[model samples]
Every structure is written in structure tokens, then in C-alpha cells.
Target chain A: MTDFKVKGKVWLITDNNGELINDIDTDQIFHNQFLHITEISEMGEHTFGNLEGWENFPEKCNPGDIVFAGSNFGAGSSRQQAVDCFEALGIKAIVAESYGAIYKRNAINSGFPILIFQQINNFVKDDAIKNLDEIEIDFLAGELKNISSGKIFKINPFSKVQKDIMEKGSLLTI
Target chain B: MPGKTVIEKIFTNHSKEDISPGKIVWIDLDVVTARDFGGPNVVKNFHKNYEGQSVFDQSKVFFTFDLTVPPKTIQYANNQMICRKFAKEKGVKVFDIDKGIGTHTLIENGLVPSGSIVVGTDSHMNILGAVNSFGQGMGDVDIAFGFRYGRTWFEVPETVKVKIKGNSSYDYSAKDLVIKALSILRTDKILGKAVEFYGDPIEKLDLPERITFLSMITEMGGIVGFIPFNNNTENEIKKMSGLDNIVPEIKADGDASYSEIIDLDISDIESMVSAPPYPHNGMKVSDLEKVNVDFGFVGSCTNGRIEDILKVWTILKGKKIKEGVQLSIVPATIEVYKQAFEKGILKDLLDAGAIIANPGCGGCAQGHIGMTGKGEVMVSTGNRNFPGKQGDGFNYLTSPEVVAFSVLNGFISDREF
Candidate 1:
């Protein structure tokens, strides 16, 4: 992909079998117990806290790190805290095969970047994508390049409204 | 114009400009609602962002205290207090802690008629689709904006048409249909898309059954699941609110364009349960034969209506559940509670050894009764069976009949057992 803009280290959300965990719901991202905490900064510490085998996501995630996940990544609950948790972590973007309806809307409205990487499974099997691998993304083209491995994968591009909403910075401004 | 789906019609009605799926458009809202769970956060955002500005319309705004009514924790108490204060200042209405679920309250109160657009804080607000209305759940930030402007931006979503075919047997209920559908369709088929259900069997579904079935679209990763308006819908509205002007404004064209189409038959559908860890993990009740149940809950937005309660009573009448199984019966709304009390349904359930709780979202939020202890297993009528949804224990979702039967047997069972 030419004119690569956003770049970051890859962080994969996989199960113990190293297979991508699909249907990673909002409850897994942010548990209901922490709903009382209103401060955005505090939400990061609890990111992925409810998820099995990923309780340490908050402690391990670094700024400018991009996350990859399986389909329906943000399933369940419209709790904005799910999206805010990633924003608090300073994550560059999340690429999943699909997303929950309201969760996708929340991320787009908050100006948090999210993309759909349809064939992430095949790439993971080929060893072309790995955790901590450097990568660059072309948002408009929906192209993701493995900078370290010299491989690229096709991704669904943002819709017109999604781009406008992200560029305008939140739904209210749009 | 080529034919248009019901969603297209609804979106076009809310928006003045020409609209299409995937197109960004600002739409007017018919109503804005928030529950205790998210109302406080909306108030906080309103003060932080739209301070000194009047809400777009006070009459259309409502605060429903159903998520954690009576304030089990100090945090929830303070949150409810904030919502009450903000609602009073804005001259809006607060349904209070005794109102049960906010969405069900709106339905019971006739606030949401067909074709109406409703925005709320509860993610399952799309449950409104059962009545042919367009309902969606958003976060506090979105609700705060909606409160200020009485409008919000939406990407018109394409529709998936699911045709429900065949008749159900005596033992099977709408909950069985929903779990069965979730198993076949899973999350991939409907994610971020609207679903239109039309077929022979669907027309026979009453409002309560429709609510039981439609409430699950969220679990299946769908934006909304709609059943076209029928005589039962009108009859329920009249019976519930004494209003007859509830006919929706639009219907899908005969030749509407659809992203995908599916047909699901229920003739062979049987009692099933969505086992622990996921809502869509459906397996036959026979498959869970020997699994002992420590607790049983027979209510929620999914199956807490009077009709469902009637089903529970029919199954448990004159028969006590297992001596050790702790059974809790929580109705969906205050109106439902009143109906049950007036009709002696609650008395029968209580006589059957059920500990009746106040009308609200029980255990679904871990807010009220039905939350399980570690190693405890609960068979619930609620839609979700998430890991920590009802408690530390495993929550298996099933029909009211099945839950009632399980409580009687002290283990998961079908009606015949």
C-alpha cells in the first residue's frame, strides 16, 4: 500500500489455542462491575479484564499499538466504556472481521478508528501476522501491510459517513 | 422508486432527504430515554458539554430507573439521584425505581408506537422492534447529544429478511424459537444489520411472544429485529394502554431489496437452552438432562410479561418446585406486576415456592435477585447467559416452561418431564 499513514505495533487478541477469538463482547472488554467508574482514564486499567486469558491487557497495551481481533469483535452491550477503554489505552485502531452494531456506531461516533479485516484467520495461519509485528495502514484504501513480514491483507474500507464522522471528531460535531 | 424495506420507510420518515443504506443522515427522534444505569452518565455529559442549554424537548425526555432500582449499592443510589436531579431541572419525567425495565415501561405506557424512533441507554432497546418501531441503544455521550438536539446521526442499515415458518408445539415457546434461531444464524449473519421477520407462524405470535423473541437481536449481534404489525399487536396495545391509534406508518414493499434472506421453521423446534459462556450456544434440553440447577429465575425483558407469567403458573400450578431449588419470579413492568397480583398469578407463583421480587431487571444486571454464587448454576428466562451476567455461576438460558420444569425436577428438563 502506498502513502501508508497510520503505523503501529500489532497486538492480537487470541485464545489459548492462538486462534482469533471471535464474538469478543463488550462484557469481555469492560465488565459490568466497573460501570460506576465514570472517569475515562481509569477505564484503561480494566480493559479486557473480564476476558479469559486477557486480564492483563490493560497493563500490557502501549500507546500506538494496533489491536487485531476476530469477527463481531464488539458484540453485546452499548456501554460506551468499551470503546473508551481502548481510547484510554491510546490504541491506534482495532481491526476485526466484524463488529457489533451499536459498538461499531459508538467507536465511529467517538472518533476511535476501527476496521474490518476479513481474512485475518488465513494470515495468522500463514505466520504473516504476529503480535508485536510492526505494521502500517492506509485507511482510505483499507490496506494493511506487515512492515516486518512484507505481506498485505485486504480490509473493508470505511463508509462515507464513518469517515466523515471520524474526521469531524465525534458524532456531535458531525 | 424500486420497492423499499420497512427500515427504508422508517428512515425516510425521520429524515427529510433521500436516504439509502450506508448513507449518513441526521434524523429526528420521536423520544429519548435513559435508565438508571446510564442516566447519570448522560446527566454528567450534559453538564460537561451542553451546560446552560435547554434540552430540545422536555416532554419527550424520560428517565427510567429500572437497571438498579432501590439502589442496592451507594454508587447506584448516587447515580439515580443525579438522574432525578437532572430530570427535575429539565422538567422531564422519571419512571422511578418501581417501573421495571425502561423499554418495557415505554411499551406499557404507550410512549412508543409503531414506526416511532426511540433512542435509549439500554443496549437491548431494539426490543422495540417487536412492535414495528425503530429502537436503538446508544451510550451516554450519544444520549446526551440526543437529549440536547432531539436528533442524532445514523447510518441507514440494510435489512435482512427472515421468514419464520411452521407451527410450534405445546411445549415450545418463543424463547425456544429465539435460541434455535441464534444457533442457526449465529452472530455473523445479522451483525450491524436490520432483520425483517415475516412468515405464516410469525403472524400468530402475540406481543409478549414477539417481545420474547425480538429481545434477542442484540445477543445475535443485530441492530434490530422487526415483525410486521398484525392484529395481535393492535390488540395488545389496546389491552395494555386502552389506545387504538397504534397502527404503524409503513410496511415493507412486496419487492423490497434485501441484503440477504433466510427462512426458519419451528415445526421441529423444541425446548433448548443457551448454555453458559454465550447466549447463542443453543442445545436441546435433553442434552442437559443430568445437569442439576441450583437456582431458577422466571422473568426479565425476555420472558417477564404477564403472558409468560401465566405460562409459568400453568406449569407450576399445584406443584412445588424441588425443595432445594431457589426460584425467583421477577415481572417485567409494574403494570405486569399489578396484572399478576390482580389475577392471582403472583399468588400461585408464590404458592409454588417462588420468591417474588419487585418488577425490574433482576439478576440480568447482577442488580437484584437471581444473581448466583460461585459454583451455583441458574436456569434463567433472561435473554443472556454471559459469564458474569447473572452471577459467578453458570447461567443457562431457556424458556419459562423449561425453567419452571427444571426447578420442579431440580435439574434442566422439558415440559413432558
Candidate 2:
């Protein structure tokens, strides 16, 4: 079990189909500890497999790194398994414009952090950007700062308890 | 401050001092329930973290294994085993195996007291409020905490008083009333709020009918929907529980504060329908033109009571369901199923071409039998009609009468008394 830290170049995905299947390369974000995005798709076996692809994409990826995706991500299935699989893969937080209600609750209850951001799809580049550098998350301030690119993004702040759970690790620990 | 509805009175009376919505109240938990699906995780977490002896009063804690029993997966089986072990080790006496009913139903028929605050690990636990209890669904962590400490915090909710007045024809029932309410409130209006049903008409409903009404509060995003305990409630408790001394704390003085109130006259209510994709998209039965249904179901925690079964039976007594429409019925509990069997309601439904299944929430969640096909339209009495909820198809919600009549006429029909 490795602790996750965001300390590499950023790679943002802007595909409407935010699936990390063979077509989309997560190598940049996974290898460099960067952020990525794509549109939400229906949750299915194929999608579950694609999520597992994160294992090969990131170098030292662990649960706790933030993922910035597009609107309506995680929009299907009341099954907690989908969210659990992501947690198992070491993706700590998911920042999207919107989420399906059931998925949001499941993510929260499972101790995964989710943040909603507006125009997030347009803020980062679609392709991999080297030297994108480390991003600092000031959870209380609800601000994300990119050290290399000198870019900053605003994220919706979570409640104090929610922040504690995210920072201290899973609800199992809390 | 006077002349408040019964629900309003009770909520205000029991509310923690200076507490309001969006803020945690930290009130005493009168009851805490858990089941197989999430119960093991909660107990495991509790044992691992808390070294205290029993936190809450043992008499107030309830546990059951309904959802994951006959375990759906190996993981589910393992979880149930852990839960059973924990329950035994913790000295919790209410653990029931195959004979156990669903948690909400069990609580209703067992130990839940009126005017008490209740929390459960399952989302549908809110359904327990039909007996005038205030219930809410909490995450596993909160539930574990409650297990470790007899009390938990809450953000006292503003009350939404719904007064249902007037008598309804045989075709309309409380299920229709709630379906209409859900259609009007959508899914967001009642989030984290309490809905109280009152009026002389509401008093006339039986326990099962009232349970059907209260069970759908979650559909409107409410924490719970309740009615003040009355003689009817006491009598039902006596009959079901065989306990004569269970007196419920009904409500507080009438002069209480309420956030909002809505009056509904059911005398003029006709058979109603909630179309696919949303429960709030409601229309009159007469307005359902060009809408064809391939499947029809009359069961769920919301509409699976004996009274609901009788209503469906009354509609299908001398009629047969339309050709090409697959109809199914599932009673909510074993006791209800036995009651229907003894009363010949199940035979009537079965003889009329309806498939009878065991008493549980099966097809309602689209997990078990009666899954709809692509583009198939189903008329159901279950709560919630979100897209692909009853399978990858369209589902419309309505009263049991409407479901029965639609099964008979091959299309949505107004229930004839």
C-alpha cells in the first residue's frame, strides 16, 4: 500500500468518452502524476476494465491522486463496485462538473473525494504536457495550483469531515 | 405556534435546542438498524475502532440479514457470515436468518417506537416512518458510530405537512396520492426533509396502505414520511406484534411550528400515472393516449401490502390481463404473502394470469426477475421510475388499481370502483 502524492507533469483528457480504454493513453498522467479528463460514459464491464488500465498508465499511482474529468462522469449504475474498483486502483479524488446522485453518495460513503468544477474540460490541454509539474491542493481554500504551468483552478470545497476522511485515508481508517 | 400538524408537533418537540436544517443536531438515536449488505462492514469497523462495551442500549439496536441473504455473491456470503458472527458476539438478540423480514418491515412489525429517531445503513430505511417514527439513512461510518455510541447527530429538518382529505373511489388509493406527490415534488424538493401526512382521509387508510405511502418518501428525496400514531397504529401493533403494552408517544401539542403545508383532496382524485424517466412526470390515466405497455407489475415495499394486493385483486376479479402484457406480483413480506394466501387474493391474481413470486424487493430494483427489455414499457406500483430503473426500459408508476386495470385493458385505464 503506497501513499499517493501529486508531483508530476499534467496530462488532461478532453474526450467525450472519458473511458481509459486502449484508445486513450493515460501514460502521461499516470507516469507523471498529472490530471486528465474525458466525458462520462455508461458504467459497464468494459468501463471497469478500462479503469483497471490505470495500473499500467501511472508509475507510482496510488489511491489519493486527484482526477479531473468532464461533466456527468460516473453517471450510471447504483453499484458501489464501480467506485470501489477506482478506489482500489489508487485514484484518490475525482473532480468533475457533475455526477449521478447515487454514484456521488457511493463515492462519498466509500471515502473517495469528489469535487465538481466548471469549465474544467477547457482549462487543461487534451494532449500530454511535459513539465506540467506538480499541482498543490489547498482543500480548505478550494484552490488547485500548478507549479510548472503557473495555472490555478478553483474546486468546490468539501465539508470539514469530508476533508478529514480524504486526508486521513479511507472511511475504514476514519 | 399552536395548531400544527401531528408530524410537525413531534419533530419540533424532539428537535435538539437551536438546531436547524444543514446543521448537525447530535440527537439521541432511539433505534439503529443494519442488514447483511452493509451490516458486516459497519460491525467490523466498530469492533476495530471502538473498544467500548455496548454503546447504545441493547434493547434499541436491531439487526437483520434480508438483502444479501441467500447471498448474491461469494463476497456477499462472506459478509453475511461476518455479520452473523458479530451479532452473536455482540449479544444482539434480534438476529434472524431465513425467517427474517426486510429491515424496514421488521422494524415496523417489531421494536420501532413512535416519535423516535431511527437510522439504518440502507437508503430505503426511511420507509420505517409510516408508524410515526422519524427515520433516516446514514453511511456505514455513521452507523458504526451509532453502534459505538447510542446517539448520533442530525440536522433537524423543516417539516412538509401534506393534508390528504376526502374519500377516494375504489380505483384511487394512497399509492396514487404519493405518486402524484412524487411527480409534483420531483426528486429534489423534499431532499433531507420530513413529510407528514394528515387529515381525516389519511386516518381511514390501513397500516399496509400507509406503509405504501411512507415507503416512497425516498423517491422524492425525503429523509422520511410519517403519520402520527393513532388508535389504528396501536391496534395494528397489537395485532402484528402480539404485544399489548406498547404505547407510542404520538406527538406534541398542536400549537407547533411547521415550514410548509400542502392540502390535497383525494375525493376527486382519479387514477394517475407517472411516465418513464422520472416519478414527477405525472398525468391522468385518461391522458395516457398512444402509450403502450409491455409489462405490468404490482409489488414492492411501497405497494406490496395486503391492502394493495386486495385492490389489485378487486380490479382483476372478473377480468383477464391483456394479451402480450407480462404481469407479475410480489408480496412485500412473508406475513403479507401468507395473509394474501389465506384470503385467496394470491389465487385470484394467479388465476388472472399474474405470476406470483416470493415476498421481497426483487423486480422493483431491476435486479432479479421480470427485467424489462430494450424499449419495453412497464407499468409498476413500485416507487421511483428513473430511466432504466426497472431494467433497460421505460417504467411508469401508478396506484395498484391503475396497474391492475392496465393489465386488464391492455392500456392505462381509469379504475372503476
Candidate 3:
């Protein structure tokens, strides 16, 4: 029931929190061109959210958008519900510098495309509002290209099998 | 030639042919466990994907609803409902709610045999390695594949032989020793390796203490951890499981191959504590200076055993917890609670100002019960002090003895006793 095609602009999320989520920081360090750095409110059940005046994220993100963040973005308790909620809200790919071990495994098994990039925070900042047209991800090249800005970021691409699963939407379909 | 170790010997004996690291060979599974938290997902995925009429083997599948049961329990009941439905539909063997023993205890009691390779969806599934079984936590996809095909692939891990020699004083428990060991050897050192605990000091500890030691091995990121089965272990297994005359393989051959061997003389190991942000960042209690504490938690699979409770009781006897320090004690299982009650340890803990919680992984999971407030400092007996792990606070990982002493002293204490 989930869509597999990667479309739309990439917005990178940075790890402004300054710690590893699951010992990996793929979101913050790896896919910065497609990253969006937003101030997350530590409110309710969610760990990170928009700072003041930016709570409407569901409207901000569209289909085929990519998200990047700091280390341990999805760290803490093993609740797949968070992933389910994110998927429902239209997140396509998640690239981070690191992730919680269990969270990384859970996200992959659930059919999300996660790329681990080392040293992501150094390239991107939380204040930048990335335009969607500037980003392109080449799975084979292990890179995320910024077409508008002409910036290319290196990445560790998914394995062939993992790519196949992502293309098919989720492992559930495969 | 590589040196032989206990893990290598066991793997070779069980392997169908000569094997090496990264080789994927099909072997018999000794045990498979499913908990309510993620078991239903595995079953659902298996039924949807697997083209089969029946399970691979009924005996190998062990089910229990530990964390989330119902209103009487700590967390929600939805996960348990799904698990119960799946068990009924498949006619799977399961342990009931009140009768449900902890997965680690149940496996050790008899559901899992010795010299077996076990996998579960729960991350802490490595707890089963206490009885010399090779156990690891897998994702739901892996479980579905395992259920459908009755086999799962694994890269044979290089083995690490940890030889412990000499005896420790009665006050020093395995909990203290493991914290000390992890402090010396960070989680990265044992990554993708199997750590086999052996030697004279291992024999000196009782089954509960041994289980406590093996329970936290996953904190070091080891693939699997274990201790060889012996007569003493067999007797304890029989006593709990009511199985008679069951003897398992004891010691591996002297020439067993191993990737590395590390020897330790821990007879003089004092109590240790792993401070916040990392489990391997440990320090001797004697070296730590006193710091203000807001919370003290004494429970979790790591330290909720009866012996741990007795130790806490010894420290809390005839004294109340320091004012403003909130202490919560969660028994690992109902059986453990009953044992504590039988020995009057429960009353002592309650009288000493500790709130008693039901048997399950509470505060440890940070879902409900004893979540740390922002900027609060807590001393706990749980494993893993990673950021936001025990709530938005600084969590210090230590033994039950240290937790008790901290509760009494109102700060991090360096006292030997």
C-alpha cells in the first residue's frame, strides 16, 4: 500500500542535539543536501519537532521528500508506531549520520530507505531551508546530488537487495 | 592455527560440516522465542508471506506476553491481544499471563536445551545465552523467514574467550564484575564477536548471579554470550523445570579454536558503576565522588532477581530512604516477587520507602513507571545509560548494592561495603 518511487525535493535535518541516536548519525552527517534542519520541540510523545511557529510539518512535507537529522533521530524505546506515523505523514527516505541500533534495524525491516552518512552536521545547518529541486540521490553512485546548487554529497548507498525492497515499497510487499 | 575456545568447540560440534566466518550454512535451531511486544508482528508477517500449511517445528517456538499485557500491567494491551490471537490461530505453545515466566528464566528452566542456537524478536533475547545457548535478537522479517523456512542465516562470528580466575568476596556480585569488565573493554571491542565467560570464578557464582552476568552481555554489542553447562547448572535447571536426569554438554575441548583469549583475575574487583551516556564508561565506586541524586531505581531483568532484592534489603534494613530521593523497585517476574515476599525482603524494601512495582521491564524501557524528569539524576541497576534511555535525565548504571547504597547515602558513594 506504500509508494516506492523517490520524487520531490530533498530537505536535510541536522543533529543539533549533539549525540548519536543509535550510535550512527546517517541523517545529520550523510545526506545533508536532502536534509532539513528544524528545531524540534520535546513535547508530547515525540522527541524532536519544529521549534516555535513551525508545528505544521504534515503540510510542509509532500510525497517523495527525504529527511535528515542528527544522531539518534529515532532513538529511545522500540516503538514502530513512530515510523508508521512518519510514513503516513509522507516521508520517503531517511538519511542520517547515525541511528539507534534497534531503530535502524526496525526502520529498514519496515521498508524505509535509510542511508548512514558520516560527518553530516559539518555540511548543513538548522537554519537552511533546502529547495526540493536541488537534490538527487543516485543509489548506484552512493551520492546525493544538488542539481540546482551543483553540490554533490557522498553517501553509503543501500545494498542491492535493500534497494529492491525500497523500490517495492516495503518488505511486506516483497 | 587459531587457539581453541569454548564457543568454537560448541559451534564445531553442532555444525554439519567444517565452517568459517561469513559462511551461511543451514543448521538445526535449538530454540526460538517470541514476546508479546513484537511476536504478533512476526506471526502476522509469516502468515502473510510464508506459503506454508504449518510451522517448521512447534516445540522450538516459545511464546510469552511479558511487557504489555492488560490494564493490570504497566503498558497497553493491544500487543498482547494480537499475540494471543496469533497463538490461538496457530495452536502455538505459549505461556499464559499469570503463569508467564520471564523469557530468560523460562528458557533456563527448560524450554531451551543446551548447545542450541536461539533467536528472538526482542533485543534482549541474548539473555538466553546464560545456559550456553547461542541466542541473538532479530527483526520481524528475520523471524518470519525463520518461521517459514525453519532456518535463518548468520555470519559465524569470531569468538572471544574470557577466562576469569580467583574468587571474590561475598559482598561483590557478578553485576559489579561485568560493569568493571565493560568499563575496561568498550562495546566496540566485542562487536560481532561471541564472548564466552569461563574459568574458576564463574563456578563460584550461583545460577542467579551467573544469569545476571550473562544477561547484560548484549550491552557490549556481542553477537552472543554464554557459559558452558555443568552439573550444577543441570541441577538448577531440573529444579525449576521439573525435568529429571537431563544432562547437557559441560566443557569444550582444550583445543577448541578461538579468535582471542582475555584472562582476568577479578578476586579483588570492588563494586563498579557505569556513569551516564555509556555502559562501558565505568568507574570503581571507591573512586567516584558524591553527587546529588533525584531518583533511585532497583529493578529490570538485569537486577530484579531475588538475590538482588536481598542485597538491597540488607542495605535498607532498619533505615528509611533519604528524603526527596524517590526509589522504585520492580521485580523481574511474579515468581521473583513471591520469592522476595517469602523471605521478608519485600516488606523491608517497602518499609525503607521504596515503591514496589509489578514484575515486568518497567523504567528500564522508559515507557511508563519511573520516567526521569528533565535534569534529574538517577542511580539505577538497569543496563545501558544512553541518552534519554531512562528518561530525560542522567542515569548512572550500577549494581543493586550500589543503588541501595546510593539510596541510603543520598549520593554516589565510594564506600567498599
Note the DockQ of each predicted structure: 0.62, 0.10, 0.13
> Candidate 2: DockQ?
0.10
What ranges in model 3 sit over 4 Å off? A1-111, A114-174, B1-18, B25-28, B50-53, B72-75, B99-101, B162-171, B198-203, B228-231, B250-269, B414-417
Candidate 2 ranges with C-alpha deviation above 4 Å: A1-86, A89-91, A94-111, A114-137, A142-156, A163-174, B1-18, B43-58, B72-76, B93-97, B161-171, B197-204, B228-234, B237-243, B246-269, B415-417
lDDT, candidate 1, B212-255, per-residue tens: 88999999888888887676667776677556786644688998
Question: Looking at model 3 chain B, which ten-residue stretch has the lowest summed lDDT?
Answer: B67-76
Q: Rank the candidates by TM-score, best first.
A: 1, 3, 2
| Native-referenced Cα lDDT, model 1 | 0.85
The DockQ-based CAPRI class assigned to model 1 is medium
Instruction: Compare candidates 1 and 3 on lDDT and give the better one.
Output: 1
Better of 2 and 3 by DockQ: 3
Whole-structure CA lDDT of model 3: 0.64
Clashes of each: 0, 13, 36
How far in Å is the alpha carbon of B81 misplaced in model 1? Answer: 1.4
For residues A47-125, write the lDDT of model 2, one tens digit per residue: 2233322334344443345555554454322234445445555655566665544455556655676676665655544
Docking class of 2: incorrect
Model 1, runs deviating above 4 Å: A1-4, B167-170
